[model samples]
Target: MRKLALSDEILLKVEKPARYIGNEVNSVMKDKEKVDIRFAMCFPDVYEIGMSHLGIQILYDMFNRREDVWCERVYSPWTDLDKIMREEKIPLFALESQDPIKEFDFLGITLQYEMCYTNILQILDLSQIPLFAKDRSEEDPIVIGGGPCAVNPEPIADFFDLFYVGEGETQYDALLEAYKENRRCGGSRKDFLQMAAKIEGIYVPQFYDAVYNEDGTLKSFVPNDPHAKEKIRRQVVVDMDKVSYPTKPVVPFIKVTQDRVVLEVMRGCIRGCRFCQAGMIYRPTREKNLETLKKYASEMLKSTGHEEISLSSLSSSDFSELKGIVTYLIDEFKGKGINISLPSLRIDAFSLDVMSKVQDIRKSSLTFAPEAGSQRMRNVINKGLTEEMILEGAGKAFEGGWNKVKLYFMLGLPTETEEDMKEIPRLADKVARRYYEIPKDKRNGKCQITFSTSFFIPKPFTPFQWAKMYTMDEYIHRAHVVNQEMKEQLNRKSLKYNWHEADVTVLEGVFARGDRRTSKVLLEAYRLGCLFDSWSEQFDNKKWMQAFENTGTDIAFYTMRERGKKELFPWDFIDAGVTKSFLYREWERAMRGEVTPNCREKCSACGAMCYEGGVCFEGKN
Candidate 1:
């Protein structure tokens, strides 16, 4: 496939022109003639957002670092661009070289969010690749996936030939290097996948066969190769500071989420929230040094002309040297127009102070994630947060002259009761009091509070893996309960209660924890115009319901039926680091309202670091 050189007029006629053009400072440009394998790192989204993602940059750096491999970027063009590409008969092309994606040896997509599922399919079709793995011939580009979503790669399992279960920092290069050798031997894609599967952390879904029971529940998944490791240990890179990272983030032609240099201060979470797939999948937390971070940020800003920099991680507050990093960013970027944003902030006084220090007092809104309303429920989920601590943080926020607070919670957790449901407003009222207590001069005086709750979704590798989630009716009723309770106490005008319609999150939980049986419903949903179901505008509950009804599978089978500890999860054949016993023990502790200290504080012995020859804690095995 020849590269279609889009005229300046045509490139502008599509959408964000950044999607096509390349050659930013520090962007990889290897000799296509010398490279043995060319990879198109396709993000199933647009350019601005894709350029902002740090993982894409890291993998881009990792692959292109190998002289034998040249990795380029591919993104889903916007609706207007897609139409134009189809009309112009133009194939999807990579950013750096303006080469057609069809010419690449490998095509990898970051399956970051479930919402991007259809977009992934669209990219494949646009790239002129087969949508289903089975339909593709051996000569087709080897399609693979990575990210937290890949842990339960069931819904899209039929699409990707390989799924990288955990960290890709080190394993990505090893897999490519191995593939390069095999390519020289003229090996088939299957042989390449088989060999790649042998690399730690890569799961070749094709090597395993899934079986289901009569009720459409996942019965078991059997690996065709007995010698194949059932559990894929998550790939961990020791000394995260030394890993290949994008020193100069891609400068976007338009605004994006971060649109700036992103430096990963850390990887993994120490606060083990059971509902979080990333927390479990990214075990044994690791961090980058403050000096290296400063250098990266300095270099990136100077090279890319970025205005804002972000410290990327699952939870930024968990960084032991967070105080120093925050202090450094504040001191450095204060005079310049540069701003630093931290995602995944844990709720606490110290973390709040960090937020307050870096952000302008008036412009910043307090964001808190209780996850659950009541303490008992929080304990059951091992949130490691107390009502008192959250209220204390709220008081500090109010004292800081903030007028609004956005609180996040989850409904439909196991063992949830009406009492727990009422706590949502009870907690909100406490925060409201703190707001009113502010002195008249500080008060511009009107205070607003928003309590938003999302329906809980059980995921793979968490303690709740075997737990049954709430039904739709129960979820809706509970959401209403919190809303009514809050409405009655606070002025309806002063408080805003927002809850997600159970339709999407419930289905998210259903498919996320579901097995190969879900493939039928997924296909039916797609056939029934459920494509782009992630979009609020396009998601149709009626179509999804019909699809499920056609498959003779009720929502309860996926969302409400609790499996026993002994039963095999449909994804059992696919391992996401951290042992089952560790999750079970954590589950037991949660049931008794027990608290497991953070990994940095003490090693919980989840068996996450046994293979690493040392414990991941500060200093223990």
Candidate 2:
């Protein structure tokens, strides 16, 4: 049995002791002496949130499949455990092996969101690892980062030794083999980083230098080492079906955010929404084979015995084999009393019919992400959703006995006006009016429309990357406008309005488009007791503002300043399968309220077709 790093006294004091204990169901265990490479896969968040992520699970299973590599999971210690570890002088350890992360060969952290930046520092501090990559010794772990945030890694570049720029399924095998070879040769840290830089998707920030202009904009970004690629092309799995997926995922002791069998139906998205970073970064949609999905689903369900299964994808409706997959799942698992959760599905007659068959109408709410209030604004964002489509979809859903509808929208999108803001309430009111139009006996209950809006933050690689974000006060004011509009509607009693906190959105914007200089602000903020900024209660906007003030950096410079058409971005060093020229063209089109068809309808030739697979090449042979 492995000895736990935490004492009984310490475990008893923490909120969730199960989080610190190892040997959870389905968790991989290996003999330390047998494995050559000891990897600590870290998610810089609390256990409940981290364990729910599917990416870490997939990578953990993949790494451990190698007999020579022993991979373990680690998450940020909660405040209670963090205080205890500091007072007791205990180094943070991984869950599986109960060994300090500093002793591991690689400390791979997934950068999922900008809000978790402070938490990343907390993890390093507790692990007794150097906060900055440059100060680390040869004995230290090779700290690497990956995920969506890595596309714009400049803000936190000083902290990571290297970043995997794209899909882990494509490049991790090569990276691990290279690490083993470097170790076999007794190579130093510098030697390994140099070797790693030569790989297609690996980005060694130390080998690149960013020169700034007098206007505080990036003048040029160039490679310092000859071995380093000038532009790191993001790695992509051309054939996703060939990649290994975790059929028997680790079942956590405590309930997690997504405590169910998650079937990843596909990767990438067909809808080219101008404001969405995910749509841009994961381009030219790729899907799994229907037969493969059915097998994985059955295997995963049998392995984990999860009572529910959810289809994971950007848009579940966009999957070419969605109906076939859904039908198969229902037929296979319906008798077992298993629930099927389909998130991110378009609200259509077919979807409504599917939902009616799988879920209890009164208990489940139908969700639609129109993204904008009005058709013109939707066109501006290239959302491909119109008022007629939304109302018609809601009408069909109401006719199918779904009384509760959730409408999602974004405030402060490019070209948004007061008229656009008011249209949100107007649109919801129309849906409510349509529900009333139904015969009294036909309706199950009164229509309840839950209207929610989040402040839009321009992200790197998106068409709106150069667009300006709204100030905190402006976002709040926009929310108030919508709130008042909803109150004045005839169906005011049926409408419920809610908006996200404006302060966090502003900070998210700063980090989303921030450069290397933003690292200083991050360090200072962490020093001033800023961690778990994503959690509303733990967030302190004043402390973040002070950090910016102390560093002499203007937050507005990143969030509120609109960039020129030809301005070089801090993240230009990477080629994320999408072309800059294509992004700029889309941006111009967005300004003109011009809508672009999805990949299945008409190819925009966004340069992702360079991969020559997925939806881009679906019918072209």
Candidate 3:
């Protein structure tokens, strides 16, 4: 039996002791002596939140399938346990074997959100490994990072030995093979990294150098090593049918954020929203075969015994065979106590019809992400949603018996005006009015319409990458403009309004567009007791501000200024299959308040056609 990493006395004192214990169902265990490679996969968040992530699960299953490899899972210890472990001087351990992560061959951390940057440092500190990649020797595990944030890895470049540039499925086999081969030949850690740098989709940050101008802009970025490519090409899996999917995922001991079976209906999005990084980075939308989804859905449900199943994708509605899969799920699991969850759907009659069958109307609420209040603002962001369409969709949903509705919007978008800010509540009021238009006897009750606004942060590889961000006070003022307008509406009592914290948004904006110079500030912030910054109750804005002051870093230099078209960006060396010229053209169109058509409507020749698959070659011979 594997011994618990923590003592019984310590486990009883902390909240959620199960988080630290191993031996969950379906978790892989192997003899350390027999396996040639030991991999520790981590999501730098709490166990519940990390377990809910599908990306890590897929990679875990894929890696463990190899006879010579043994993969395990790790998560950032909750604050209660974190203090205990530090006091006890216990090194962080992976869940499956309860062995110290320092014993592993590789430590792969997923970078899903910018707020979790401090937690990355926490992981390294607890594992008793060197925080900086340069301080490590061959005895330490090779710390690597990947996922959406890897598209802009410069901000945390010094902490990681290497970064996987794109989708994991396509290039991981070669990377693992190279690692084994290098070890067999008795190569040093640096020698192995040099060999790995030559593989596609792998980035060795130590081998690269960044130059800055006097104006605090990127002067140039170049590779110092001959093996490193001038531009790291993002790997894309054209044949989704051949990719691995985890049917038997590990079941958590406690309920999680997403305690359900998940089936990915597709990859990428056809919608070209200018401010969305996922839409741009995951281009040339590719989808799985309907039969493949059906098989995975049934297998995953049976293996986990989950009552709910969610269709995962950037935009579920854009899946060409959506109706076929939804119909199949409803018909097959209708009375079997299985619930189907379909998110990211564009509200339409077809969607309403399908949702009405699967969801309980009284318990569920309809959601619409118009992203902007005014149609003009929507066009500016290329949201492609109209007022008439929103009202019509709300009316249909109300008639279908869903009285609770949620409206999502973003503040601080380019070209936003006072009128645009005020229009957000007015739009929600219009939807509320549409609901009340139905007869009182036919309605469920007083309709509750909730509208939420989050401050927008520009991300890399998107059209808004060069846009200027507002200060915390400015973002709050924009939210206040919308709140004051809500008071004047006729349906004021029926509507509720909420906005996200501006402090986190400000920090996230700085990190998103930040360069290599920002690493020192990040290091200082982590040292100043800034872990779990993403949690509202634990976040300390003063500590972060002091860290910036301590490191001589100017927040305005990263967030408050706009970039010139000719200015070089820190992420310029990444070839995400979308050309810089194309992004600039879209930025120009956004400034003109002209809406660009989605990928299905027309091809703008954005350079995603280089993939030569998916929607890019849909009509070509």
Q: How accurate is candidate 1 locally (lDDT)?
A: 0.78
lDDT of 3 by residue, 462-537 (tens): 9999899999999999999999999999999999999999999999999998888899988999999999999999
CA shift at 306, candidate 2, in angstroms? 0.4
Query: Who is ahead in TM-score, 1 or 3?
Result: 3
lDDT of each: 0.78, 0.91, 0.92
Error of 1 at 62 (Å): 1.8
Cα deviation of 88 in candidate 1 (Å)? 5.4
Model 2 residue runs over 4 Å out of place are 610-621
Model 2, position 615, has a per-residue lDDT of 42
Residue 252, candidate 2: C-alpha displacement in angstroms: 0.7
Q: Please rank every candidate by lDDT, starting with the best.
A: 3, 2, 1
Superposed on all Cα atoms, the candidates' RMSDs to the truth, in angstroms, are 3.0, 1.6, 1.6
Ten residues in sequence with the least summed lDDT for candidate 1: 611-620
List residue ranges in candidate 1 displaced over 4 A.
1-26, 83-89, 215-217, 347-349, 549-553, 610-621
| lDDT (Cα, tens digit) per residue for candidate 1, span 446-495 | 78888899988888889888788877888889988997788777555667
Model 2 vs. true fold: TM: 0.98
Ranking by TM-score: 3, 2, 1
Q: List the residue pairs that clash in candidate 2.
A: none
